[model samples]
Target: MRPDAVVIGVGNPYRRDDGVGPAVVARLRAAGLPGVTLAESDGEACALILLWQQRRLAVLVDAVRIRPPHPGQVHRLVTAWPVPGPLEPDRGSSSTHTVALGDAVRLAGELGRLPARMLVFAIEAADLGYGAGLSPAVERAADKVAAEVAAEVRTWATATADQGP
Candidate 1:
């Protein structure tokens, strides 16, 4: 069944701090809110685009490497973001291939497959090396983000129910 809402974490758990997204999803899974789907992707854009298709909302979590090192900072970004438009990478950069999460979001926008309401929770990355587990800063951020995203899912569920299915 198509979920009413989804939380997709885009990152590689094997790669240190980059796994923050998946970590957040892991927590959400344990929370087990009805009508919500939780998933993890190894920083794959195409998979994400397909996951949220026809959904009412999609909340994406990802790790970003940036200057000044604000490790573990949870950035709430994007809500009905204008896609198919120019997007200069800000806050941080996705440690993925040339086509990163931002590009994937734009592609979804261009393809008109974006959700009715969408949001991105970007975490400042500390380490992205070949290893398991997140850095201290990122781990804390992931836990915090998981709670916030869960709250969002609850809110969406309530609102969706109020609208009468």
Candidate 2:
């Protein structure tokens, strides 16, 4: 049977900090948690919604290109939509090839495709230049975020099982 929840790391690994999402996905797979599907995508909104369809919970991690002080910082937003309201904005690191995260979430919400419970982890990015390596700071943060995500996945899995099919 498929897991009750899904954690998706979205970003392009070729772009420095932008690769954080996929990096976290790699960590989760290494840990090998049962019943939780670990996956990575190109950070496209529609694809994200499809990947998370009908799942009870979804955790999404992405590299955010915020300003000075905010760069290298990690923030989590729990909202049905992805607007920047109280949340800070992250710039597009790679070439414009996809929809903004907020826009995607809004589209999903409008189309009634968002999961029941969702958590978005946005890590401020330092450099987005064309490269396959992360800045020292963002690289350090990858592990911390990965660990937190794994623990959350485990907790969510347990809680979901307790509720029963």
Candidate 3:
């Protein structure tokens, strides 16, 4: 059976703050929201597309490296399905992924494989250096972001249920 929604965590845990995505996923896993699938990706475009295909909603959590670094700031963005056009990566921030999330969204749009709705939660990073754990600020942000994602999933589920079969 298809899940009502999927959350994709895009980042490398070994890369310090880049691990925020996986960190958020771990929290959601513990919350155990029904009918919501959770996945971790290296932020590769194809892998991301596959994770979200056919779902009603997709929520992506990732890390963004911005100049002069804010460490733990979170940014939320929603992309309309059948995306109007190719999305440019967030201004002043670069993805920690090999392929930017915007690129994946564009590819999915072109392939006609986008989910009905998509959300991105990008956390600013203080460090992308080789390391096994997130920096202190990013860790705190992870907790906050996890709660936010859980709330979003619950909201989506409620709305979906209200729509009826």
Which candidate number maximizes TM-score? Answer: 3
A best-first ranking of the candidates according to their TM-score comes to: 3, 1, 2
Q: Write the per-residue lDDT of candidate 1 for residues 31-150, one digit (tens) a residue.
A: 887778888887567888888878899998988776777889877876555654323236435444356676777778889888888888888888889999999999999889999999
In candidate 3, the residue pairs with backbone N, CA or C atoms under 3 Å apart (3 or more residues apart, or in different chains) clash, namely: none
lDDT of each candidate versus the true structure: 0.81, 0.78, 0.87
lDDT by residue for model 2 (36-104), tens: 778899967778889887888889888876544455577877865644443334443322235777777
Clashes in model 1: which pairs?
Answer: none
Clashes (N, CA, C under 3 Å) per candidate: 0, 0, 0
Predicted structure with the largest lDDT when compared to the true one: 3
> Which residue ranges in model 3 land beyond 4 Å of their true spot?
81-89
lDDT of 1: 0.81
What clash pairs does model 2 have? none
* Candidate 1 residue-wise lDDT at 63: 84
Please provide TM-scores, in order, for all candidate models, with all chains considered together.
0.91, 0.88, 0.93
lDDT: which is higher, 1 or 2? 1
Per-residue lDDT for 101 in model 1? 71
